[model samples]
Target: MTTTPFSVGTFADGDAPPFPGIVVDGRVHDTRAVLPAAASTAALLTDWDAALTALQSFADAPAGAGIPVGDVRVLAPVQPPGQLFAAGANYREHVIQITVAHRIGAAGASEAELRQQAERELDERAAHGEPFVWTGVSTSISGPYDDVILPDVGEDFDWELELGVVIGKVTRNVSAEEALDSVAGYTICNDISTRSLIGRPDVPMMGADWLRAKNQPTFFPTGPYLVPARFVPDPLNLDITLRLNGETMQKGSTGDMIFTPAALISYLSCHVILHPGDMIITGSPAGNGSHYGRFLQPGDVMDCEITGLGTQRNHCRTTEH
Candidate 1:
């Protein structure tokens, strides 16, 4: 009695508008055919519990025979989430690499000294530090297969592949122990950034200008689909990998994260009411272009994947003037 594994996403055929679809065995079945509440992926998420039940039922006895996946255009699982929260510097190794490269906080220190200092700081932060979370405009989202149009203003566009968590129920001040219960599903996201625009020379004390550096259109390439939380056994143990033009650029395990997804969600919920369809992207692993002294160029391609969520392949092109 083996059950077919399934995920959900938005898709379109020919010129038809996007609709929520259940994906199983490389086939797409219109979710509306079974669940009228699924007018859109966002709408379906509003009642995620009921939606999950109906989706599971549909998976048990699917109708319409599901269309071949290749025939439809896959869109981002949730386009322009109601709210998008991103955690930065959550991975200890990534922080150590960045700290050593930039000489952060310990300027003029030797590389070995910087590495030792960064490790000690990470240990302290992991024991008592809150995640560095921030708001991101949802319009930056693009489909998994869409072209990432490098903005004209920035010279160093880089990739930061991350795990995206989708909120299911209304979540406020949830405890870390119970945070997983609030998750609807998980997806893959590439948090693209403009390295040159991250700092503000005009206001050095103000810290990194995340909005300017990261919120450009098509900067966030998310989802081939969203796998329900039930399908993922352990969010913190998945492997995250990314390749640029067929060369592996980033590869690390979620185990390296200083603040786990549940912790980040719990921390975020303390401040804001997380509604269904809101997204939280956990920070990326080490190996951003900045670390390697490489940056996106026209015609570059990025291939990214997490263990079970899915894969995303995006082409990079300069925006037309």
Candidate 2:
């Protein structure tokens, strides 16, 4: 395994077709000559072991001219993953945030009391509860710097910045201890949701409507690059932060996660088969728009970043279509 620190991403030069490139020292080197199978970043991930070896060799000594990262448009590292799984209520504080937003507590209880109650619930969950994983449409994936068009269907457009784990191989029924072995790398993703559309009161038996509430196009802002898992050191200890319009909004650490990536993946593998290039986004931290009661507005800019996994700046615009 190569220990050299490097990342992979998709980039294009001014209307030119996008190509996968090896990113090191702030420059992007085309992988076309280095790894013939790398038609896309997702393809490279299918055979991540061999691809990582070739990429490390190329990074050590680039074969050709490299382009300055700023000269080209950086796209989502994995345009459309094979499968996208999202974990909900995976952060202690985030669970409390959601519960408080929905008033899922004793009627007339104070916020402090509700918060404490949520904390107790979380402690119980950590001891006994299984992770709650859900499927998300892959088409919702968008480039890191892409504009988030607030769909006219819902008013509460929100942001939930998260840590995304990319699968390296076909895996099924893996244990938590071995789940990390299947992880190729990590990236950043903002799971944008429409708060107003989350509920299915008309058909209350169905619970939350994650599909319509979360799968809007350009909603899942992901990736500037995918940093190899070897460079991450400890996935659970990374810092997660999001600033809205230059003001700090969400600030927390991955350590606050109620379910670790491995635990979540292990739980998921019991039913769903994870394939190369599949993704599982661990839940967001506490400070989502719901916690602040301030949702995304037209022209709002959100700066999201995770330790090592590059940053994403997405501007929100109102879109009728």
C-alpha root-mean-square deviation, candidate 2: 1.7
TM-score of 1: 0.97
What's model 2's lDDT at 37?
62
Best by lDDT: 1
How do the residues 14-52 of candidate 1 rate in per-residue lDDT, one tens digit apiece?
988888999987889999988875689998898999999
Output the lDDT of residue 142, model 2: 94
Off by over 4 Å in 1: 105-108
Query: Ten consecutive residues with minimal summed lDDT in candidate 1?
Result: 74-83
- Provide the global lDDT of candidate 2 against the true structure: 0.90
Q: For model 2, how does the per-residue alpha-carbon lDDT over 156-265 read when each residue is reduced to its tens digit?
A: 88899999999999999999999999999999999999999999889999899999999999999989998989889999999999999999999999999998999998
**Worst-scoring 10-residue span by lDDT in model 2:** 1-10
TM-score of each: 0.97, 0.96
